[model samples]
Target: MTQELSPCIRTVNVMRYVTPLREGGSMPAIVEADDDFMYVVKFRGAGQGIKALIAELIGGEIARALGLKIPEIVFANLDASLGRTEPDEEIQDLLKASVGLNLAVHYLSRAITYDPTVTTIEPLLASKVVWLDCLLTNVDRTARNTNMLMWNKELWLIDHGACLYFHHNWTNWEEQSKRPFVQVKDHVLLPQASELAAVDALFKPILTEERIRAIVGLVPSEWLTFNVENETAEERREVYIQFLLTRIANSAIFLNEAQHARQSLI
Candidate 1:
């Protein structure tokens, strides 16, 4: 696979420790940054580990490539000293451990959580979002936890730290790539997605190996250097690129599965 660089992801310095969003397991925080914007920061020291941040970078970028709406993703620079003022030991420890590069998602002001009853989505847009989630094996977009937000009357995707799950267990990831993502059935937008085949046709060609590699390339070496099953950091990065390439190559089976789900639901 070709290794070409994409536009560099912007990096920002965290200025203040805003309130922690405790609803989710990771306890991500809403903080103000040196850029004068508020961001929902996902720390590398979180229990989910750096691999989760890798997924966020790769998954969020791919969503953007597919013309889906997602908040701006940036590398958040945290200082260990920032934890000194916080009284909460948990947050203090988290801040200290994440004193380097972390993940920051631009916080959308006045954005409401997506409610199926309150808002309706265009069928084509819904299909595209569902297709992309399926391709990434994201199981976090279910009704109980639709990680989607509505801002300025447009739907925006978020919280992709739970995606690209195959990396959680690298063993036999090649075989896992071909497996159908059954979780697509529970996707909040699946019922409204009637054009699965069209979505497949439109996106399949766009997600070429080079494009996927470029997205993977956006991940920081620090995040990818974790020792996984004795594989070197570079080797682990290659594994991510290979897994995605395999998934794209075998997308027909996954697309068929999505179509079957849509047929049953719609």
Candidate 2:
């Protein structure tokens, strides 16, 4: 339950566009960077827009704070000229528009996707992951689309852009924060979780206001350009921090919902 500042997200320059990952609606691509590291770059110009990137930053960082394994995230600088070399018009447009700051997740070499039938997770880890998805109200981590990776025999969380859905409708985020996360029932790890209350007790105290603020602070100012309810970008950032603080303060509301989900699954 101790609070500590997370390391600042590193910034890198994209050197080469390797290939596009066409699996998801948002066309994230595998790109090589100046640091000699490969990354899965999430372009700001994608249909999902910059809000998705913000959610990925905040949600992924929060997951990291909760002791879950995730690839290192970085701010990738993309030059517009890199798009002209691509033949595909779609990718060309994406790259051209994403000529500034983009989000990139460090690629895990030879990592396998998590398959429930083949992989058995420990109860504590399962409970923690389920708890995290619930807290973030992430609806994408269901059985059909388990956004998890198995690398080096360890479970790693990924693709958290679908979280923090309240941001999409920022008119009443305060009320939305207090609302129960009803999507917990569909979480892929719900059946495997054996200790929901224990997970709550362990994480609730650790995610203090200071820690949440630090996580939100990691989001770049350019990505916070969306004006919600006439609030400026800086004001919108504070609102995000407040929404998270409210949700954690009312953690029991979502915890009870998750415990019920676990009971039904068991």
Candidate 3:
């Protein structure tokens, strides 16, 4: 949460707006954050608000917590006044034409999708991305499709808001019971895990208790849920945080390494 939320800090010189994503891109204004920034604007779309946005920011942060590379979240001023060129018109109408600060994301192309089994010099990077997905309990990266971005053969991971065991809640009990410990492990990540063991090393210092708490705290409460029905926002957030923490703690053998790293810093 060390990120600054200043309105005048920077202006996103939106490049060509990407067409609304068929799957999950429709709601947000996925425009480049600024001329120098690589990420794009992620606005509150149709169902835009606390619960839905909470799913996005928090879910993405959780992925980063588990040693995955993800786009950084930046708060930006996206009022109707700031205009360069419509990145993609289809997604434009879906946006609130109002001028105001919106949740903007850093663009990550390497984390974009790529064809699996494609030859590359840094195939190990691909393995790391997959392993990161597993640690997050991400079931989205199945054989059906993988999200990746390639640069110099290095692969990046993206779009995990629907992951972290979400499908478990929506699936039938019998099917859910058949799920793997970490769905990513069920794929080809395990056999090639050693190839990217070093990637785990990078996360050790970043996953400390304090660091994790800050991230969990930075998650805007409204994003967690809209009508708590019975509980307050704080109560719901604590409950959600506790659940996420349990999942992170049980994810993998390397988790201890990240934990120990966090402890030493404390």
Candidate 4:
């Protein structure tokens, strides 16, 4: 039960909407912030809504906690009037809807999508990535959509809004926490990830409860109102914490699932 320092993400004001990535349903866009840096902003008004933002923040931080490479995440402030002059009606509508705080990651220029066919990842690193996705129950890291970028010859994880699927249906979170991530079979790196057990041992202690609680604490209070009846920010945060802690404790389940999946690939 060691305590690690909790990392705090900075808040930035969106100065200009640069362009839309338009890759996912969320319509994440590249925008210029007050700091004069570019970020890929995930709009709260997008189809996935704030839960996606929460997943991005928590999941990205967790990846960073495990010593993985992830772009810096920031709280991007969007003014209500920022989109008034935009010519496109749809972009204008999205901007107007997301006129408060949004989640954004620093824009990595010239980074190419990870092509597993061309570049190879070391076994331990591949195992670590697979392990992280399993812990978060992320379903988007398959071969069809790797959700990884190769920047300066290093792999960077991104787009974790699809993680933490249990939050989408809160009725069975406790049960879901202990379940193995069966989707590991589709994971892009599973075949290369031969060191899951070693990675499990090395990473488990690094993500102490204190660190996890701190990571969950990053979710803004506004995003937790998805369930107006019972899920307050405090309660929702607790759910994330408990789910992750339980999943981490039951890591053997997913580790075995991933190992079996790899064996099938052989």
Candidate 5:
């Protein structure tokens, strides 16, 4: 499939702290920005920390590269004094901890959560979503928690912090890249993803090494502070790019795994 070049992620300054979204463990909140727009901001201080933000940035951009609909992601700046007026101790602590930079997505007002039982996705689209989650090894997109929303009659992917799970440990990343996504069986869209082979062939070439590098480059150096291997921010970026390139080369491994899983479901 032909695709356009992905643009750099925009930066926005947080102006107001709206209500907190309690759905996910991260405690992402609805906040107004200086741009006069609302965003669902994911703080760096949450339990999962910056690694989750990195995954959110990388995975969401990868999906965008594949022409998937996703909300606009931005780097939000939070002032140190912003949390001082908060009455709730929990939110106060969270804001105090996330005082510098955070990740946020443009709020999709009036969007409804995607319900598989009530709405059906076509085979090609379903296959693409499944293929994406598999490639990212994303563990969050299951029937129990479909990280999708229906806005303006279009499907928008969201909450990809659970993706790229290998980074949490950062061991044998190359080996992990070639492993099969056994979780495919639980993917909410797997039953309709009948075109895995076709999707695999069409999608593999789209994630070129240079394109992958560009996506990984979006990560800021500040968030790469956690050193598991005494590696610099640039080194960490290379690791992510290499992992994805290796995974794309070994697409057949996971594709076969997904196809087999689909057989059992059908």
Candidate 6:
């Protein structure tokens, strides 16, 4: 797949990527695109890294396809024409136009340590996060709660590069928790549960089993993996995939989708 991402988008010197982000940037990386803007970049990683990117791309698209409020983003490729280390003059100009030099982002985080604190993030807002994860089958966010960002009253969840129903082999979920997310039921999204369910209601339509299977099939091939002529590695990968799809498709609680559909054929 060709990963060249320049389509009338304002480009920037991604190499000049800043660090520590004045403590309030969306992510810690030297951003190549503005928050509201959309640009593409070649995802950096191989094997699992590539799989993670594919999962992210698919999950992000699926979330948006479900008519949910997703953080604006796109996949783009870095232009190597610029010297590997040289500043991307064009990118810098784009950044200059996109943001104010004196501008500071009000980071929505309460603390920085990896404490057991669940964060000051209100329970209600946290429900939307649960909804997002349920639909995406994100396993990264845990009760210990190290994967969220709160800005103002709005809660933005991140680190979904690890979701999309592939945390472990999904072949057998019968033993897993099938109980409803009662804890978060009264948390926040409950008020809009019907509406939220409707938003993701069409997922079954958009991501039919066949379609989901195609995505899963592309996992190993499309992901980044070093030269693995070893048969054992290939066998392990196959086993993992077999179980992965089995569990993800059959599980109901985490991968919950409304029974309603514009077209039915999940």
- Per-candidate TM-scores read 0.95, 0.96, 0.62, 0.97, 0.97, 0.45
Q: Name model 2 segments beyond 4 Å from true.
A: 1-4, 227-229
Output the worst ten-in-a-row residue range by lDDT, candidate 2.
222-231
Model 1 residue runs over 4 Å out of place are 1-5
Error of 3 at 55 (Å): 4.1
Deviation of model 3 at 263, angstroms: 33
lDDT of 6 by residue, 28-117 (tens): 233333443322232332223344554555554444443443344443334443223436554443333332111121233352432224
Which pairs in model 2 have colliding backbones? none
Better of 3 and 6 by lDDT: 3
Error of 4 at 20 (Å): 0.4
Q: What is the C-alpha lDDT of each candidate?
A: 0.87, 0.90, 0.50, 0.92, 0.92, 0.39
User: Model 2, residue 182: displacement in angstroms?
Assistant: 0.8
Question: Which one wins by lDDT: 4 or 6?
Answer: 4
- Across 1-266, the per-residue lDDT of candidate 5 in tens digits comes to 43356558889999999999999899999999999999999999999999999999999999999989999999999998889999999999999999888999999999999999999999999999999999999999988999999999999999999999998778789889999999989999999998888988889888998789888888998787664557788888889999999999999999999999999988
What is the lDDT, from 0 to 100, of the residue 3 in candidate 1?
A: 21
Output the better candidate (1/6) by TM-score. 1
Q: Supply candidate 6's per-residue lDDT for 196.
A: 40
lDDT of 4 by residue, 82-157 (tens): 9998998999999999999999999999999999899999999999999999999999998889999999999999
- Candidate 4: C-alpha lDDT: 0.92
lDDT, candidate 6, at 153:
42
Q: Give, for candidate 5, the lowest lDDT window spanning 10 residues.
A: 1-10
Pairs of colliding residues, candidate 4: none
Ranking by lDDT: 4, 5, 2, 1, 3, 6
